[model samples]
Target: MLSWPDELTTELRHDLFGWCELWSVPTLADEVTVAVSRRLTSSLGRANYRHQRVTLQHTLLHPMAAALLREVLCHELAHLAAYRLHGTKIRPHGREWKALLIAAQYPPNVTYAAESLPACFAVHKRFRRPPARRSSWARLTQWIAGIPCAVR
Candidate 1:
């Protein structure tokens, strides 16, 4: 089972507020519920219910630290922003998610590291061109596979 480090949680809260400032969305408290469950199959994190809540699976928290926390937070918050802006009408990782990610200062491509975890979990070193459309679950499955952790 995975659990968030105290420092990581603190930083995640700060960054979420920062994202709110950038996107012009209302600021949310660190009250975002994060759980590290073994049931998840993707290295990716999820923000469900229109940013009202979020969950970071245990495998997703492999190497914890400040930078890694920020990357994870941004990645999950990107999902929240996408859901909030487009709702169920838009694809989860489509254009809106990519735009919000870049706007939040992360590379457009969903990145993961192979060796020791990256300073930023999902921020790839290589720059990737933004996709034209929302990513389907199939694409997300592929993306998640690229992460070094085992997806249960």
Candidate 2:
């Protein structure tokens, strides 16, 4: 099986592969490429179904708790599972993806609580904003944040 960098343990890999097998996904357990990405910030993980690739924040696995790792890992992997079963035209975190998560026994939350990981906390700090901002600006920010990642 292809190893996920930064020590995503062998057991965890087996579990993920098993999930793929159980779901009968097009992506094989050994065929999926999981890598540690320096570019991932504010996000715990990302999936590119077209490339059959998953890029996780490197820090997320450095001494990370297994539960947190599984949560994030399952979350990202479900995207590929969903795409394999459905199609790319579907929303990134829409019903199809959520259903995959449910079947996989993972919470369907799209965003993770990064404060749990030290490295992710550092990334969060880099993007932290002041406590106060203009109301209009805050409203605009909320509106923009609501836009889908695939569209952005």
What is candidate 2's local distance difference test score? Answer: 0.60
Candidate 2, residues 1-152, lDDT tens digits: the string is 56576477878887888788777874556667888765565455667666777777654554524565576677777777877788777776778877877788765654422222222212234333324454533522332244233211
Question: Cα lDDT of model 1 overall?
Answer: 0.52
Mind giving the per-residue lDDT tens digits that candidate 1 earns over 54-105?
5554534444233544666676666666666677566555678779878988
Cα RMSD (Å) per model? 11.7, 9.8
Q: In candidate 1, residue 144 scores what lDDT?
A: 47
The residue-level lDDT of candidate 1 at 46 comes to 54
TM-score of each: 0.57, 0.67
Candidate 2 segments exceeding 4 Å error: 1-3, 111-152
Per-residue error for 27 in candidate 1, Å, reads 4.4
- In model 1, which range of ten residues has the least summed lDDT? 114-123
